[model samples]
Target: MEKRYVLEWLDRAINEFNPTQTQSANFEDHRFKSFLKEVMDETARQIAYLKKLAFQYPKKRKFQEVLDLYFSALNNLIDNARLNLKLIASESVISKKALELVLASLADIHTFLLNRYTVSINPDEPLRKYNLAVPVIDFAQPTDNILLSNHPALASLIEDEFDAVFSTGNLANITPRQAKHWKDLNDQICTPEQQNPGDEYFCSLELLLIERNFNSTKFVKYLTNRFTSHMEEYASGNSIEKLAYIQKLFNQIPVIKGLAYDLQHDDLSLTINNWFICEIEFRSRSNTGKGREAPSTATKSNGCIKKTADKVLCKLTVDQLALFFKAADQSKIIAAKSLSAIFQAVAPYLSTPYKEDISHGSLRSKSYSVEGRDEEQLLSFLTKLTRQIEEL
Candidate 1:
């Protein structure tokens, strides 16, 4: 809201980015260039930080430029289109820099959804406005805290070293005019955050991919040697041909394979519950005997398939399977609009206590067995893979 302060910072950033003719020729040094880049990145962080800050208040409203510039910066970073780059600025500095079209189609889809639903809104219940969403990688909160919280033996014991891994410090203290990366949001600053052998950080995308690869490789090896040898062939990417092949592979399994362990004991005997879920995904037909025509659509908010959805009939009894299969056969996924009709027909049988608050979407997570189970199995594989990764 401080126009003069923001303008001063903006001018400084712009000058650093592309020095004007009045500025001395000596300003074109490496350090100066680096400073400019830092300023530019910082500007983005400031804008993003302010946008996030606004959400914390009761009267939630974006400071107009927040969404516009947030997406604009992301578009620059990923070389993708911002929200309305074409409509707003066909020749924007940010638009000119964006070479990749990965997010353009997604933005178009969002735009279509917005326009399509904008007119159909109930006068009583006004549509809720959403701020621009940043990628999972760009959050101020580190996933290290979430994933590593349970591990007290190492994560906590090496307190000083753990803090060292997080490079950014004091995110909340960010000035509205200043830019700071997600790393700026640090818990502690004066800690031995430096890297030591056997205590490598898995914070960046490169490290994450390495971790994923390690797990995937180990699991594939275990699956091929211990279980099925043709898992690599079956459990591949979600190409249309691969999906068809995976469906055939899934069909070959007589019963859904799961390892049940004794979890709970009651006063009388034992009580069994499916605690850790392992589901699979499939490329089903459009209910018209079409091959891989209809994309696997889930009613789940997190893009996961609900455990109790029709897709999980494989683990059910013969009669139960038949009933779901009949219902599935009647349903058509290719025609997405047809889903409402299907929902109406199956409303009585769809899992209950029916309906959810604004928060929870699907009752279950996405645990599909399409190419067969991978998520939980992948997690199980990680323990072994972690050791192997350490060795490397």
Candidate 2:
């Protein structure tokens, strides 16, 4: 006979949570078991409801986040139950009350998960009412010959609009150094012949549309590429959470948003792709926007925007970051001995207001549940790790 694992027993208990119909010697024990079964029934009902919705709309991006959160919360509860099972099995005199702890813990997590899901996810009615149909832009077919003839004027208008967008400080909180880097890179993209490159035109067109602040064109790139089943895709190569933020940014006249949307839905051209990947290298050593009170307030606001951009640009999710930490722990990537130690070494850079608030359970959950600070923290931590790894 194969030896049963502790986790298997725990799973069985959770799956068949119904208590025996026979009355227990103690009335308290019978009542507690009855109550526990009701809680388990409700938990099962919620899970089934969510699972059905998830299955019905498997491709719904918004719903996917909620599903991930539910999964994370459920997994965390199960992990604790597994530990409880091991303890119960080890005892010479097993306490039935201790076994109840496994199911009891699920109640709190389930309640929390339900509350979060209810708050974050809106009803499908609102989303369905707002139709975002993609417009057809056939580059080969010109709708108007006269408009085509005035390409130079149109180009200049686009340039001026984008200039206004930059001036408004509404784009991703880019510093002087970053602005200069892009300017210099644009020059490099301009060929010796000075005839506009295909990618350069497309990139400009995207920026112009963003400057115009049209929602229809916001995800035009994604819709186009996805519709065409375009082989040239970048979103698959990056973190979906990060890419989601990038798309949100784009919807707000944000450069990071454009980059994120392009990276996700369409093929970002070689020039722009290089710019996106290498942008971290162009950091200015000193703070340029310092000293003045006005500049300081602007800097703080811009700082928030930059943090959002960084989160959008991040390639790794918290789960992926966790895996990296696990790998590093296994290989002794850092001199730190344990996973907790490795987390501690990097916590100052990644952890929130309180480093003590950083827990493995929470980090694991944030991977699925949407959290901006966690996304930003993971991105910063991963970027530092990647740079250091390159040196080694």
Candidate with maximal lDDT = 2
Q: Single out the weakest 10-residue window by summed lDDT for candidate 1.
A: 267-276
Per-candidate total of colliding backbone pairs:
13, 1
Per-residue accuracy of model 2 over 1-392 as CA lDDT, tens digit each: 11233134335544333234222223244456665665566556555565455555557785665455445546655655555444443332223453465466465545555555544432222211111112222221113332223354444443443454354353433333224333432343242332333231234434433443222332344433432343234343333333344434433333332222122122222222223223211211112223233433211221232221222233343444565576567777666656666654443334221111234554544334444433443554556578899999
Report the CA-based lDDT of candidate 1 relative to the real structure. 0.31
How far out, in Å, is residue 66 in model 1?
7.1
The TM-score that candidate 2 achieves is: 0.21
List residue ranges in candidate 1 displaced over 4 A. Answer: 1-13, 16-218, 229-320, 326-392
Clashing pairs in 2: 250-257
**What is the per-residue lDDT of model 1 for residues 216-288, given as tens digits with 9 covering 90 to 100?**
2222233224222333445333333443343333223322222111112210000000110111222222222
Residue 181 in model 2: lDDT = 33
